[model samples]
Target: MAFHCYLWHGDTATAQGPKRDTLCGDLSMATPPVLTRDWLRKPQSMLRRKASTPEEAVNWLGEVFDQHAEKMTHSQVTGIRRQDRFGSALTDLQAGNDLSWGFPLVGSKYLALAVIVVR
Candidate 1:
């Protein structure tokens, strides 16, 4: 199964990279970080989602990751350390701070998300 990757910043989000088996490679080979860095450099490329509250924004991202993992991997992911990291980043975003979180999916493959407050 392929893992979908997304980058969410402010009120905009976009799917990153092509759909492929993302859980079988090293971090250096992962596409999420590269796509995220590119997006951060050129954020105007991102499309806006419908207006939503901060909590809803966070929940939407969490649900996307969780639901994808459950559906594709056939296992529920809960109480994982990565969830805590994502929660911390969400808190930082709510606090008006920029933050980034990296999650190891399987093997050396990783997923990275950042919440950057662009002036």
Candidate 2:
């Protein structure tokens, strides 16, 4: 199976497909012919954290949950479906604020993460 990423708004997924122009809608030559897992890596310093591997992602998610458990009420950590939105989700997850979960799909074929904005 190919990699898929998604952007979720809640129990209902806000976006169910890839966002890159090449992957969806009218294709463009500027879009790279090759996609790499590099999209899965969170920038090392941006959020004061990084996750180079699926394992690290899981650990980071747990840390965020633990640190914020006392303050969070209705919000809960959850899974994300793969589509084409890894970059955005990873950004939120790395920030460790409104983001909660960041991990790869069980089969290793896709990356997934969850975002929970408490507004």
Candidate 3:
């Protein structure tokens, strides 16, 4: 079973030494990070995420947002339905597997997101 997720660059040093064709000793596989209880609790700390792939991560988030985008707000009043600076990135779960929240761009204000999770 494949799932989608979002991916962001973690504070990792750039490639200095010869690139290791094998990320985790397996050139054909990528060592995905662990999705533990803490991950569900505090995602910021982990910084790193593990999904089927980078693209998958983005798609999942897009779908998540698309579902409840209408209930968010008509703030812009532009009628295009765009995301605002102040919103939930992944919050509003209330107490179930559902949630709604917002996130702010740190390094770059021109943040970009990917849509993952194949239909």
Each candidate's TM vs. the true structure? 0.44, 0.28, 0.28
Query: Against the true structure, whose lDDT is highest?
Result: 1
Model 1 quality (TM-score) = 0.44
lDDT of 3 by residue, 51-118 (tens): 55433443456664455444444542234333532123222211112222332223322111322223
| Per-residue C-alpha lDDT of model 1 across residues 11-108, encoded as one tens digit per residue | 11212334333421223332333433333443333322322344555665676566446432323255456668467756765676644555445433
Residue 2, candidate 1: C-alpha displacement in angstroms: 30
Per model, state how many residue pairs clash.
0, 6, 16
- Relative to the true structure, how large is the alpha-carbon lDDT of every model? 0.43, 0.33, 0.31
Residue-level lDDT for 37 in candidate 2: 27
Ranking by lDDT: 1, 2, 3
Which segments of candidate 1 are over 4 A away from where they belong?
1-39, 42-52, 68-87
Return model 1's CA RMSD, one decimal.
10.0
Which lDDT tens digits does candidate 2 get at residues 1-119? Answer: 11222121121111123553333222232121122222223232223344454335545545544554443333332233322234554555445434333222222222223333222
Q: How would the candidate models be sorted by TM-score, starting from the highest?
A: 1, 3, 2
Runs in model 3 deviating more than 4 A are 1-37, 40-50, 76-119
> Who wins the TM-score comparison?
1
